[model samples]
Target: MENIDKRNRLDEAPFQYRINKDQTVFIDYEGKQVKILKGKEAEKFIKNVNAAENDKAVQLIMAKITGNFKRGNERKKR
Candidate 1:
C-alpha cells in the first residue's frame, strides 16, 4: 500500500473521476492524479483486468503467486 500525505487530506476525501476532452479516464484518488484509461489503451487494461478474475486464469495466477512471484526480479527470462 502507498503512504498518503497528511497535508493532502485525501485520506478522507472521496475519489473523483472524469473523462478528458480526449476521452481519457482520469481519477483523482487520494489527491493523486491517477489515470485509468486513455485513447486506445483502455482495451488492453480492461482485458488484463477481466482476465485476472477468470476461473482458469485465477488458478494459474495463484500458482505463479505462490511459486514464482517475487520482488525486484522482473525481466528474468525463464
Candidate 2:
C-alpha cells in the first residue's frame, strides 16, 4: 500500500470529524464544515475512521468521503 503520510504533509491534515449526541457525524475541512453524515453512512464513517491506523489514513478517508476538494487553478495560501 502507498504511504499516505509521504504524499501529504502532516501539517496539512485539514480533515476533522465530530460525532453529535444524535449519532450524526460532522466532517470539517480547514475548519469549515463540509459534510454531514447520518444513519448508516454515519455509522460506517465512524467505523472507518476508528479503524484508520494513523492520521494520514483518516485524512485519506475524509478526502474520499468529501470528494474532490481542489480545483487545479487554485493557488495555495502562503
In model 1, which regions exceed 4 Å deviation? 1-13, 40-78
Root-mean-square deviation of every model? 13.9, 2.3
Question: Best candidate, TM-score-wise?
Answer: 2
Cα RMSD of predicted structure 2: 2.3
Query: Mind giving the per-residue lDDT tens digits that candidate 1 earns over 1-78?
Result: 023232432334434445567666554444555446665765443354367654444333222323332344545335
Lowest-sum lDDT 10-residue window in model 2 = 1-10
Q: Can you write out model 2's per-residue Cα lDDT over 1-78, one digit (the tens) per residue?
A: 365444454448888899999999999987889999999999999999999998878888888898876655776677
User: In candidate 2, how many clashes are counted?
Assistant: 0
CA lDDT scores, all candidates in order? 0.44, 0.84
Q: Roughly what TM-score does model 1 have, to 2 decimal places?
A: 0.30
The residue-level lDDT of candidate 1 at 76 comes to 33
List ranges where model 2 is wrong by over 4 Å: 1-11
